[model samples]
Target: MILERQNFMNINQISAELEKEFTNKSIEQEDIEKLQALARLYQLYQAGANEIGTKLENLDAEFQVNYDHNPIHHMEERMKSVQSLLNKLVKKGYALSVENVRAHIFDIAGIRVVTNYIDDVYLIEKMLLNQSDVTLMQRKDYIAQPKTSGYRSLHIVVSVPVFQSTGSKPVNVEIQIRTVGMDMWASLEHKLRYKTDIEAELVDHYGADLHDYATELSGIEIKMQALYQKLNQYKN
Candidate 1:
């Protein structure tokens, strides 16, 4: 899939929109500058995500020719809007500044990698991390140790260098690797979690059901992996 950079609003446009939204709150000029800078930082992050996605695609293509199978099924990329970013900062009690954003938010720019099998997820991850250009900052293996909600994915935080006219700076990008089953569960759970006008009790019930479903899905994935391994052994 081709990766495209998204257009961001300019400082004036962002300032006007924020002023309209926060009618009572005074948005100072300094704050506007900081927001503008934050927007630019997001652009850098977007570039980093695009580069990473491209590398993953290239690796998949190479594997297809040599191994007769592609590890990566698809890739998805997104960047948070200015309003959403501000809301999250406020909720986290963070000051509206570039430093605060860089320090607190590791997922402003995010990429998701969906693979055919559980092994494929780790294969692609190892390939990406082996690259000299990608600097591994952190990693979380949710597939091995799932959350209470049974969320399963390999989360990786890496820094990629973005070359600017002024200089080169490293930007952080969050990469999530998951199997097809895991992706399906996560997608549905996210939708239900964000549904409005739903009763609190109903939301809790749904959460419980989703957790149980996720556990079943994980078990199915393990069985599928074992079956695939057995088939490979027979072929060999």
Candidate 2:
């Protein structure tokens, strides 16, 4: 699949729009649940920024996540330096027009889970599926059967607990599990889509090389991370 760049503005711009829209809106019929969901989304963004930022606070001043690119601006390049979970209450109705709400949410909410190996991706997928508070709505294993365009990742829909005053209620969440290699390719692809729309470069010269490197490195990563697993077992 081609990288798609929507009319996605930065967080600051989105916030300004929201402030303006809500400021003069005393008569708009809005549901409380939808508003609460939007609030939760903003809160999650803050939490993610905090968690990743603090963990890498002491990193080298010159160190960057992407190849020759600034990590702070493009946050996801830091090899799992980013972990995001978005919550939104999509406006739903019992009709075809509203049915697209669910589709659109998946279009943007889930993050690309970049791991080092195929096993890592499977482990994460299984771990979340086993969660008592999470319900698996669906799963599409693309790693096993990669796309015609050479994309490798797993897409899953899971519902998580959202504890309301009454009790804990299940809320659906979108999860896309991949590898660092996948993220690199996806990142470049997204950039190209922005530059040329669909008619972007048919094959990324630099991206193909990066993909090969990631595939080889992933093997080493699996071995190294597995050693840690063995250590934990031995310690136990």
lDDT of each: 0.83, 0.47
Off by over 4 Å in 1: 1-28, 233-236
How much lDDT does candidate 2 score? 0.47
Query: Per-residue alpha-carbon lDDT of model 2 for 38-142, expressed as tens digits?
Result: 444543433332332333222212333322212222223111111121223223322212233334443323434555455657755665566465577778887
By lDDT, who's the top model here? 1
Distance from true position, residue 159, model 2, in Å?
0.5
Tens-digit per-residue lDDT, 1-236, candidate 1: 33334565565665566556557778777766765686577667777777787788899999989877878877888777678888889999998788898888888888888998999999998899899989998899999999998899999999888788889888889999999999999998888888566888988899899999999998898999899888877664
Best by TM-score: 1
